[model samples]
Target: MDMQDIENKYNKLIIRIPVFLGLALALGIGIGFMISIPRKNTVSEQSSKITEVLSLIQNNYVDSLGLDSTANFAIQKMLQNLDPHSSYFPSDDAPLAKSQLETDFEGVGIEYEWVKDTLFVLYPAKNGPADKAGVLAGDKVIAINNENLAANTTQNTLFKKLRGKKGTSVELTILRGKNIQKISVIRDKIRSYSVYAYAINSEIGFIKVSKFAEKTDLEFTEALKKLVEKDKVKKIIIDLRDNGGGFMDRATKIADEFLEAGNMIVYTKGKHKRYDQEYLATKGGIFEKGDVVLLIDEGSASASEILAGALQDNDRAILIGRRSYGKGLVQVPFELSDGAEMRLTVSKYYSPSGRCIQRDYKNGKPYDKNLVERYKNGELLHEDSIHYDSKQVFKTKKGKKVYGGGGISPDYFIPLDTTDLSTSILNLMRENKLREHASLFAKNNKKILIEMGLDKFDKGWQIEINTFRNIVGNISMNTTQSDYLKLYYKSYLAKVLWGNEAQIQIRNTQDKAVLKALEVLK
Candidate 1:
């Protein structure tokens, strides 16, 4: 073949193998395959050597090993040694892993909390198996099929017992108030909402994006319109505190709703030119000019940073909270014929300010370890504690300074409030049957509470000490002077009476980070 033929062949090869990474689509989750077959001779030689090694091991090794399993293990380790984010998922696990970032999953459909090694139902998914079976929130799960789990149980065990092939059934015993009853539920797929929106007050709209799932942007649009109609909301807060991230497309679409057309939302770069891409905001945003604030913390990463950094860089919103979880590398998925998948890092995503928010990985420390080190180094507690390479600094559109090689530093840093964790009453609340108490309270007064609505419930809600004593059977544990018990109590009632959504709005009324956002809006 002539030189022209060689170039044509190369172009065809590149086109056949699509670049796997979609910017921030799965920062920490994306993967791409890079197999360079350098001129034919070297390629054949290396391929033969690898094949020979595998053959020798399979035939001559003393220990017997399954060829497919051994090959998969080697592939996984090879990806791991390359970077922290690259991962391999087996055939059985790949689908489940994908569903986690999506909106729904097959299960019993109940939000639950563990207390004292016992499982307690929080809020059953609407129309879900648990709800259909009359499983109410606060029902303490004592046993599965008469196999008592209260003594030796874990989240995994609970999940194993509660979830199964859709349309299957499981037996459970629940303790509701003074009554214990048995219930059987058929497992089915459950919808997991990513966007939670509510009016914080008449003036401030609160929108919490749990993760940038496929439907998040659509959910957010509907929410924005409702807020716009609700007496003209003056300020909006987008909460991404613990949102690790999901689809980059969803995040960028949401960001577009707050930015003018022609404005850059984010961009990505990798070693290969094909990996370069840029996203820009389109025209006609619902709240493009409205005052906005983004709430972030150590858990905000990837798509979270994409939205916050875009807004902050464009001078469209104020970031209020702790520093974000730094995750800038992008990956793309390469599916194996065995139904397994390998996610390979392909590029680094840059915030609108031109900062790649990935923290240093040169030391090969895991992200979890890095977080622990941050706490030890006083970085999370103090802004001055943040150490970054001065040379990696970048400027936002409005001339504000930003740094790379770490995460996005909030414009207004708020120290985490750990008082609740240490508060005896709070610990007691978590460890005790608070969920059951909430459930019973809502059940007993459902008619009256429903009529009251969230507004009236918040204003006139009362949890008498006598009532509290009755709920816990007057079980005393610890005392706290914190004074948040009232709100906590009310929020639970709201959850049981209405739904999980209503409960969050009520709880946000007292959330410290949320309060800080409101103050900033003021």
Candidate 2:
């Protein structure tokens, strides 16, 4: 054939496909289509198929699967990848954790500590059921309701035994000064104080709250009355370091005492919203007009932010300390189908002046690393080193400029004091050697330590340096030490055994932030 005729024949052959051969190929394609998913479908269909495969394994696999736990764990992993603060508390942990942030819990009304295997009574709240029944400190718990305590019983186990619904009776067999006696006590609502008010030298009223709980407002009022009116306290120093956060309502209640009514305390909003919801100060305050100073540091967050923000904004209180840990998300608890709950961030909380004290949290980026970044940038060391992004500025009612998208900046930046810190102390603390040493010290000198009052122990006490040295000498490590480290360890051990307040007293002596706050009040 000629070249043109051959080309025409080739085109016709391609179209025909040998008739029967083409029919067989088409039949095979149709059969494959009947069994397999179409390639033209969206990617979602492929994901659904993979999910179904996993579900099958979870349901009818050879081994029984913990499907709920697996799913929650997966969710937790996903959230962790987002931010450190975005944590998932499972059903078992949620109640216990939530109680600490709230006002009260159902438990026997007594504070106790475990020394070795014995439980030592610390303090009983005044008018509390335990106190009414005459439970005192230094008393030891030997048994509960005639049941001999299991050998090496942990404090947590003891707590589980003691804590129950109100009106429930828990019998405690006590060992008091070599005398054993059994006492039946009624379980009641244990109200934890958010504000502890006392006078320092009859002049400065000290109110140190660990966090803002549900009953913080009422507690604050009672505390203020006891401190200011009853004790005749003049200036107030509110310490809020290491207080991560709690109820915002309680924060506003505390702030209202310092701020006049109608002042905007804080605001909140999200992406879909335009104008923010503002929380303002209402009527009725315990100390509507008083000289107040607030203490803050890197650990202060959320509700702590609200109180600090309001106090700072209203100029009613002088904020003295380092910058706070900015965490401005407001979380709401939602229960899953499995009784497990998730504290989902509902909105971004803003200070009264429209400053969102939440630092940037972008997807796939590190959030907790901000503190390290701040330290490297010298923000922890000096106020001058703090540079604000001009674009994220907000102004207080008084027109004082404040920055958003970060934590609340203290009016007075107190540099972190590492003067007393040493490699020896840090190592001991991290390794829990100090705790062990405290236990030993308590066992040996229980009576002698008890005789020494907290005040006397705090003032004249020196940690048994030789004992500490002997312990440290036994430790197999190469770490430098200082005179302060040796003495500090001794003091810390004494504090842990003698009383928890002892450590605070010792730490207060060297805490630059506390001193700075005191100076501001003065």
Best by lDDT: 1
Superposed Cα deviation of residue 253, candidate 2 (Å): 0.7
Best by TM-score: 1
Q: Candidate 1 lDDT, tens digit per residue, 63-157?
A: 99888787778778888677667778777656656655656677888888666656878788878899999998788888888898765575446
Worst 10 residues of 1 by lDDT: 12-21
Supply candidate 2's per-residue lDDT for 421: 36
Number of colliding residue pairs in model 2? 0
Error of 1 at 340 (Å): 1.4
> What lDDT tens digits, residue by residue, belong to model 2 across residues 360-445?
77744445455555656778788899888799987777778778777888888888654323344445544445445554566567
